[model samples]
Target: MVCVPIALIVVVVLIDVLAPPHIHLGPLLVAAPAITASFAGPRLTGLVAALAVAAQALIAVLRDRDELFSANHQAQIAALVLVGASLVVFCVVRERHARELSQVRYVSETAQRVVLRPLPHRIGPLRVASLYLAAEAEAQIGGDLYAVARTGHGTRLIVGDVRGKGMTAVGDAALLLGAFRGAAHRQADLVELVTYLDGSVCWDLAEPGETDRSGETFITATVLDIPDDDDRVDMIDCGHPPPILVRGGRARVINAYQAAPPLGLGDLARPRYHVDSFGFEAGDLLLLYTDGITEARDSAGAFYPLAERIDGWTEDDPAAFLHRLRRDLLDHVGGHMGDDAAMIAIGRAPASRP
Candidate 1:
């Protein structure tokens, strides 16, 4: 960038020195300051402007040594100086704005880390990898959330999506994650774990001044329990997308026969959360994701066909499968999604003996 301004100054000088006298190449010197405004700050721009002024004076002297300060050259010198000063001011403003933007991005990333802690690679007998893509790039974390914990009975995990966006949604996601982490160790079963989370979220929004949002706020989550020695995975779906089971080079969605209403609206219909069981054999992989993955759309308004894509990837390693899925999803949506997305891939370790 600095080179651009310097080069412009050099070319303008050459033209002024070598070109025909009637061509009047002095005006072109302003290009130095103008180009510097794009990439350099006030100090650098001012330096370029000074050089331009000096070059103009030199040209004036070269043209008529006795008339260097005469009226004819004075007007041109004043114009060049005015334009350079204006460009210096513009550079100052641009640099200030850039610094402010950088600071804002730093704060946003810090908040994201606080809300969404990193997922571990190994949990109990399963090898795990997770991914999150926020719809709003400025907001590193949105409504999507996932967490895993090793409990006394087994390894418990939850993948959830809050109802809204912005800080409110982030707060709700944090609340649910915190509740799950605390309750997973104490609750003996999946049902109890989910019940604790539901009650906590329900009560959180019902607080004195928070009731205004209570009517609309809710979270859709899927809770899972993988026992240490069992060959099955248990799930409790609360108005969320179903998990997918991959085994023996085939893929299938594990839909729940019964699902309760999403938490925070349990007062509307107090149905019991059913625990759905599925066979998780050796070398099997389980995929849990939020709606952002399935609901992603292309220009033609077609939804992402996740199951069809996964069918061919059933035999791929868990890490490779997720990598392909993420790339394919981005391509399906033309590289921009309108909602926050998250996915967790859990592969049962084959070496473990029951």
Candidate 2:
């Protein structure tokens, strides 16, 4: 690719030298450095520009040796140098912006890893797989988050989405995740763990001068506890989408009978959190996701049919299942999402083990 611009310069020089002197193809030489700036750095682009200026000088000498210092030749050479120099300047600015963007991306990725650590492929007796899709064009992660923590008796997991998007939502998400990780193991049950998270969110939002919309900001989350010794999973829903249970080639939504208000709204709602138990037998797969997944719309203004699409998907491996779901969801939304989305698939492995 680097040779392409070099060869272009050589070809243009040859054509200009061989053509009638009146044609004056010297102006075409500017293309060489312009092409170089697209793919090469400032130094290389500057080098190419220098070569182009040299070629222009050669053309002038070839056209008329005695008239080398004539006004026409000097103006032509000056124009070529100016254009080439401008291209080199463009390359320098472009490279600097590229470096800055790379640094920003690195920091964003590191923060995402810390706030929403990847779920282990295997957690105790369960096979887990998770996916996060950020709607922000410049961001790789957003307000949607999921995390897993192992306790003495079971594994606790939380999948949540903050009320808004952007940095504010991300801060709220980080706060909730940190709170969950800090108290998930110590808390006696799912209800207590969720209460702690609610309190943490409330405290964070209640901070003065945080935001004008603090009153409207809240997080919808589903907290789950799956004991290693039991076939049942305990859940506490806080105004989140109900998880789907896939068992024996059938999928059904596990709606909570007594749902509570979203976190951060506990003070206003005066809600009572209740622990809901559901059968999560061996070979069962549970999917928890944010509303972004289901609310995504296509060009025709139709929302993605998540449940209908995965109704009979018999893929037992959690990773492969989520992969298929991700592809399908992206296709349904025409490869662009309007909001952040997150999904987690947890499968209970068979009891018989080595």
Candidate 3:
């Protein structure tokens, strides 16, 4: 539908070029974007149309003083009409888009509430915090995802990255979330949960149909379980970045004690998972994230430093810490994200005095 008007603009331009002695192309030209004004987003379409009309109007006004029958008067009328029509279209389309955007946001927010429920402010004497950036500004869902649930075993957490974006990625993500929520509760160990997720992915792969495109959907994930607040934090690195542990105001990456392949396509070979244990002490911060954070690059292609970036910024608030991280990440990436990002922070408060 939006392409139709763009085509109309091209035709109008061609017609004017071919037969400029007759046929008015200016109004049609102005109306072309005005047609897309209802779809290209109100702000963008309106701005573009305004600039286009104003530029031509000024050109016509300037040239009229020196020319005979310069088509200036008629152009001015058409420009003004288009501008006015664009404004009206902008208002109506803006309202419609606002409503649609609101609905998408609501759905996304609901999905977040259901699938990415925030960890409690305090989880077993530790402060729980997190941040999430969906790849699409208009869509609530993306390929990166994370979830934390206090299971019978302990605080179970899962962070995974799906392939691609848009509707297809969202569908895959939904499958993963359902698997995690079910298996997280049913399975006692994180490794078994990994197996369940692998099976689920393989199942979903078949649904997308066999494509000889030499492409398959796979997810890089990390699963963690905290047995207690002061004990070691158990983590399974299934291809995610090694989480960072901050203690005494120092941040350090916790390398996987053992490495394993990413989830999905595991039937190609037997998958092995190494559970790494990290020292969890009072006043220590544990940050887990998807690849989006580490992969965020500046205009110069300098990748973001996941572990070393926020060493000295000390705020006792977990949410604030993650929020600041998100802002810094966007600033580094020029306010755009090429991939979905998800993160969760678990910090142990200073131990109660003995």
Candidate 4:
């Protein structure tokens, strides 16, 4: 690190000596600090800028020629002015970086509050637990999404896999959720709710290159509606992975027939959407996840065993179960996921007297 700073100062001094005096070296002071913050952070950037300005001032003092300015006093003033301007530029760049970071953090926090509500250590007569991970840090939030809404019709929930990743995927995800939340609050039928989400996603992708699935890029989703009255639940699967249901001390993966070819891939002439039904017994658990979990790989090129892990996760409290699963996943891949990973587990309250 010390060698790097010394090397940088050497280069700057060489440029200052070789370049014409009027070459306008403002970029060094104006851009360097802001760029540095991303790599070395704010404090180191400040130190670097201060050191650079001091070096420039020293150069000016050592090589002063009194021909153009015609007076030693005027030359000294010029040197001080240039140094002050450089300092001001560095300070302004630092301030701009701080403001930009503050805004990003604010938006990230707000997105979490609105789009990804914290799982209630418990949810509506059930113990709810979840885990979410984003592969790319640039997107703290990714394309995969899920939400649980208690409504007039039932406690409606849905988990979806958007066609792409990154910002475009996030945009599509926001559209789908906005529709789901709106329809769940108003529409009583599970069929209409899924239809609403499907139509909304298709309409939003009406623009060019939106529906173009680059490589089977389509939104796969499963919508579930568990009525408050009983343990029965109805689901709509659109090519997404079947959620695993653990019950009676045994774990079984719940797979419904392919009702549709996922959202955003449907044509006007295609067959209609079909809703599938299932029953959630008391004391049973359901786990929903995107492809990321099943696709995670170890360096030796082995797929992560999500199903095996879920089997082992049985009988533990929701939190501890999720914790164990998360640790095993990290150990499998050496602490990183290549894509976004999302898991939601909802368990019915323990057995009640008839």
Candidate 5:
């Protein structure tokens, strides 16, 4: 690739020198540095630009020794040099921006790993897989979050979406995840764990300056506790989208009978957190996701029908199922999403005997 630009310079110089005197191809030399800027750093681009300028100067001398100092030739040389200089400047600016963007991406990925750690492929008796899609083009993680924790009796999980996007939403997500990880093990009951999370969110959002947003800011989440030896999973829904259960090639939403308010608004709603128990058999697969998945719109403004799409998908492998769903969802949204989406697939494996 680098040689192509250098060869271009050589070809242009030779052709301009060998062509008729009336024909001037010196202007084409500017393309050499322009091409170099696309794939090379500032130093290399500058070198290519200098070589192009030198080649232009050579063309002037070879084309006409007497007219070397003439206005026409001087202008041509000056134009080539100016264009090359401009291209070099452009390369410098581009490289600096590229470096800054790389740094930002590194920091974003590190922060995401800390705040939204990936779930293990296997947790106790369940095979789990998770996916997260950030709405922002340059962001790796946003308002959508999921985390899993192992307790003495069962495996606990939480999937939540913050009220908004951007840094504020990220902070809120981190807060909720931290709270869940810290208290999921200590709290004996699913309701107790959710209560602790709600209190944490309420306290954080109620801080002095945050009073204005305290009422409006809330996290919609669903917390689950799947006992290692039981076929039923206990759940507490906090105004989040219901999970989907796929059994015998049929998919259905596991709606919460008694839903509670979102985390931050628990005080206003004064809601009672109800623990809903659902059968999660060995061959059953449960999917928890954020609203972004259900709310995604295609070009025709039609929402993606997730339940219908996955109704007959009997892929028992949690990872493969989520991979197919991710591709389908992206295709449905025309390859761009307006909001962050997250999904977690938990499949109970066949029990093992001692």
Candidate 6:
């Protein structure tokens, strides 16, 4: 990049000296700073500007005695100086903005790490893999959240989507995750754990100005329990998208017989959360995802066919299966997601000791 401006200086100087005197090429030096803007920073831009001005002075002095101080030469030198100074200012401003953006990205990354800790590769007997894709690249993590914990009853998990976007929703996700973690071990029952989470969310929502929305903001969540010795899984769906069960290279949604109202909306309607049972034998995988995957759309406005795409991916390994699904989903949406997407893949070990 430094070589680019230096080469431009050399070429422009040679052309100015070798061309016919009737045509002045000294004005071409302005390009040095403009070109430097693309690849180099303010310090290099200033150096290029200095070199250009020096080259202009050398040309003026070496060409002819009268041309050195003539009004035309003075005007050319003034224009060059003005433009070079302006480019230096441009570089300075650009550098400041670059530093500011870097700082903002640093803060965002730290927040994401603290709020959405990475999922472990193995939790109890199930191999686990999780992925999070934020709609805005700058906002590294959003309202979508997932959590896994071992308890007296089984390995408990929750995948949820909050009501809104931005920092407020992220705060809500953190709160819910904290509540689930605290309650999962002590409650010992799926309904009791979910009831604790519901109380926590209702308490948070009842606080005025804690959330941005005025009325009826809620969280849609799915809670799952996989006993270490059992071949079945239990789920409590709170108005969230159903988990998909993959077995024998086939994928099918496991919709609950009756879904309870979303958390924080239980008071509006009498809440009756039911535990839906499903076969989750060895060599089977359960895929839980937020609406972002199903709601993702292509250029033609067609929603992403997540179930159809996963049908062809027979990889039972949680990591590989999720990696393929993420790639295919991005390809379907042309690499732009409109909302935060999160997925958790839990594959039951094929062989377990009795």
lDDT of 3 by residue, 1-354 (tens): 766765665565455545545554555566655666656666556655655465445444444445433665555556656675656676776688889988887876676556565556776666888777766545646677777666764678788887776556666777887888878878868788788888888766765665532236777888888875447888888777888887777788888867777777676657876677878877677888888789878899999987778887675567877988988899898998766688888877676787
State the RMSD for candidate 4. 8.5
Please provide, for model 5 over 1-354, each residue's C-alpha lDDT reduced to its tens digit, 9 standing for 90 to 100.
889889999999899889987788888888888898889887898898899888878887887888788998788778877887888788889888878978877777677667788789999899999988866556545778899999999899999999876678889999999999999999989888888899999899778876478688889999999999989999999999999999988999999999999898978888889999989999999999999999999999999999999999989999999999999999999999877789999999999987
State, as a TM-score between 0 and 1, how close model 2 is to the true structure: 0.83
* Candidate 3 lDDT score at position 122: 76
lDDT of 4 by residue, 296-339 (tens): 99999999977776674556466666777778888898898887
Report, for every candidate in turn, its global Cα lDDT versus the true structure.
0.84, 0.87, 0.72, 0.69, 0.89, 0.85
| Preferred candidate (TM-score higher): 1 or 2 | 2
- Model 6 residue 286 CA deviation in Å: 1.3
Which candidate do you rate higher for TM-score, 2 or 5?
Answer: 5
Whichever of 3 and 4 has more TM-score, that candidate is 3
State the RMSD for candidate 5. 2.9
lDDT of 1 by residue, 255-341 (tens): 999998898877667769899999987688889999999999989999999988888575546777789889999999999987789
Deviation in angstroms for 21 in model 6? 3.4
Poorest 10 consecutive residues by lDDT, candidate 6: 208-217
> What are the models' TM-scores?
0.81, 0.83, 0.69, 0.66, 0.86, 0.86
Supply every candidate's count of residue pairs whose N, Cα or C atoms clash at under 3 angstroms. Answer: 0, 0, 0, 0, 0, 0
Off by over 4 Å in 5: 133-136, 151-153, 186-188, 208-211, 292-304, 327-340
Error of 5 at 315 (Å): 2.0
Better of 1 and 5 by TM-score: 5
Tell me the alpha-carbon RMSD of every candidate: 3.6, 3.4, 9.1, 8.5, 2.9, 2.9
> Candidate 4: which stretches are off by over 4 Å?
1-113, 136-141, 207-217, 351-354
lDDT of 2 by residue, 155-203 (tens): 9999988886566777889999889889999998787788888888888
Candidate 5's C-alpha lDDT?
Answer: 0.89
- Residue 225's lDDT within candidate 2 is 93
